[model samples]
Target: MSKVGIIGAGLSGLTLALALHQQSIPSIIYESRPDAPLNIGGAVMLSPNALRVLDRLGVYERIRTRGYTFTKVDYRNAVTDTVTEMQEFGGKDKYGYDALRIYRSELIDVLLEMLEAAGVSIKYGRKFAKVLEETERQVTWEFTDGSRETAQLLVGADGIHSTVRKYLYPDLVPKFTGLAGITAAVPTAQLQAPVDLHLPLTYVLPGKGGFVIAPQQVDGSEQLIGKQRRVEKDLTREEWAAFMADKESQVKFLQDIDPAFPEVVHRAVSNIPHDKINVWPFYVVPRLNAWSSEDQHRRVVILGDAAHAIPPSAGQGINQAFEDVYMLSLLLSDTAKENNKDYLAASLKWWQESRQARVDQVLELNKQIDLRRLPQSQDSDGLEKLNFEVGWLYDIDLDQVVGNWLKEFQ
Candidate 1:
């Protein structure tokens, strides 16, 4: 059987490993972090687009048990305390699946368990440092620990700062979107539960200088979720705190909004400090001229964030990476069967051509979202414009979206 080496054990890498394992394809995953669980952030809104992939991976039900489902979304402007837009998610439960608000850790645990049950091996602390292609038949990877291994193909699922991407496209770098967002999970007991916490999975209140409020149920318990307004790039902790400290300015703007909404916002601004929030510096890499290397002798590929990094505005980052795993597996299963080296090289080329265009479109949409959320005047018209654009983003379907993307590869 042909061997595959995947860099990064994140959502993308692990999902790819599981999909490959389903075909009885063997692969090893190398993660740079210590062999321990790290708390990266609080919760995430998993739309049905991503849920479909989890279903195929056989862990959807497990995740659902630990998450909360809701059927509607509300968008409001904090400055004037006006309701900007409210949309029904077409009633997800009516369609047999509902959108979910889940703790990030719970989602990771589910993915990790599914991978292990399939006997997939993941080596932590094995940082990807370099890739060296030997003779036409094999490729070797150099790790931070001075260890090396060769395989028929190398997959760079390493995330935003992918070492594989650096080795392949050294000149390209992830450009910060000048937008910094902060997120944290506080206990449900802290907030007065929504009148119908069980009905709506999330509530987003957009604020000036780039802020949003999302209420999610992580473990069937309500949690007050808050995110800072989007900025141009990453912010220092001090800068984030300073923005939150502008109490008079924020209160003057938000005091009249629905009592429940501002109560949550006021508590968020007053209670949570920058140190307590998980702030991700938003960045993206536009589609490149080519996502694969030349020469039939060596076969190395990039998947997920390593190839295309999208901001969280669209919530498609994980789902798109899952799409990458699914399509790549389909191509490789047909060509790399029985360890056929010649077929492996041809398969990767097809994978690249098939996935690049679609990935680029997703990236573009995220950029559009980031741009639309910039600080706007405290007027209903401006907020209305923002809502029109934000609605377009949350309403995308991953399976159909990516299916058209892979049509060419077929």
Candidate 2:
């Protein structure tokens, strides 16, 4: 029997299966989508911390040639075209792996392949309905089809709107941050960019928000041009679908270029691929009282966006999720030994607290980056120029963490 039953076959769940398999722990994944794993939002960015986890799981080498790698993002003055600041997202020499931007489907396909090689099973078309029962030793849940399954532990990695989370907080809903990011893909040749312009940049339009141009694809032929704006009201699903379906409106929304930015900005918005348009409404799950059940069972667990849909400023959304599953898998192995039943609750508590601490750090990093984006003011907020450093974020050693924590109990 599968020791761990994972709900959702996205990055977190698939990666969790691999991590568990490495520790000789068996796991099964349940995905609602009948045909494929949950692969949306186009391409995703990965920093060093996540790269380390993927490398350890033997996923990085296979995907290395399928993505564009970079180390820094230049935040430039839109008018003068002068780089105002630089943020290092990754560095092989410093953090041991460069940042990667790859298509969501490509990564998911590779993960699925790896899971197959590892003999991990994934059940498609299985939607998690709700928790049927939970005890100190195991968990059982039902699907929307009325079928039931049980496992030694249940993990909810079901993105932002998670059904398993309902078992913990019945009324909880993801809080929209009142901002929506609209973007589209365009050929790099369309921009006709200057030779020295660095890629993956945030061109700060004078008073308006930043306009982003990030390169993607194996050859960097395509770039994602994006901008965000305040959204006062949250649209319904049908409304969102209609809004996105109108290609004319999406073009107009992205083409609202400011006069302060370079002519390249106007050129980048000249022709956006209709099929490549994407809109991401920012939503965050509030800091929860518990990521796991508070009772003695602690059988139902939630990670990734299910627990915290962190702000995207730091690009740690999926990266941090990788951290969660990997660390949890390692800890789960420790508890698998005989006579460790007494420490089950304590182990989970420590895991949640430890993961929460890193997530809190990432949030703080987001605030710092946002503050840095403000217009240079000699007076307001009294904010001094701060250099971006990510050693603490990327240089983490999860094995050391597991070992150190076990020592406390040993």
The model with the greatest lDDT is 2
- Going through the candidates in the order shown, the clash numbers are 10, 0
TM-score of each: 0.77, 0.96
* Candidate 2 local lDDT, residue 1: 21
Identify the candidate with maximal TM-score. 2
Report lDDT per candidate: 0.63, 0.87
lDDT for model 2: 0.87
Q: Write the per-residue lDDT of candidate 2 for residues 118-229, one digit (tens) a residue.
A: 9999999999999988987789899999999999889999989999999999999898877777889999999999988899899986656688999999999999999875
**Model 1 ranges with Cα > 4 A deviation:** 37-39, 79-82, 87-96, 193-210, 218-220, 229-261, 268-270, 273-276, 295-298, 336-350, 364-372, 375-410
Q: Where is the poorest 10-residue window by lDDT in model 1?
A: 377-386
In angstroms, how far off is 278's CA in candidate 2?
A: 0.7
Considering summed lDDT, which 10 consecutive residues are worst modelled in model 2?
372-381
Which residue pairs in candidate 2 collide? none
Candidate 1 residue-wise lDDT, 19-132, digit = tens: 888767899998898884344656766665566666776878898878667655555555554555554432454444677777778878887888878888898888888886
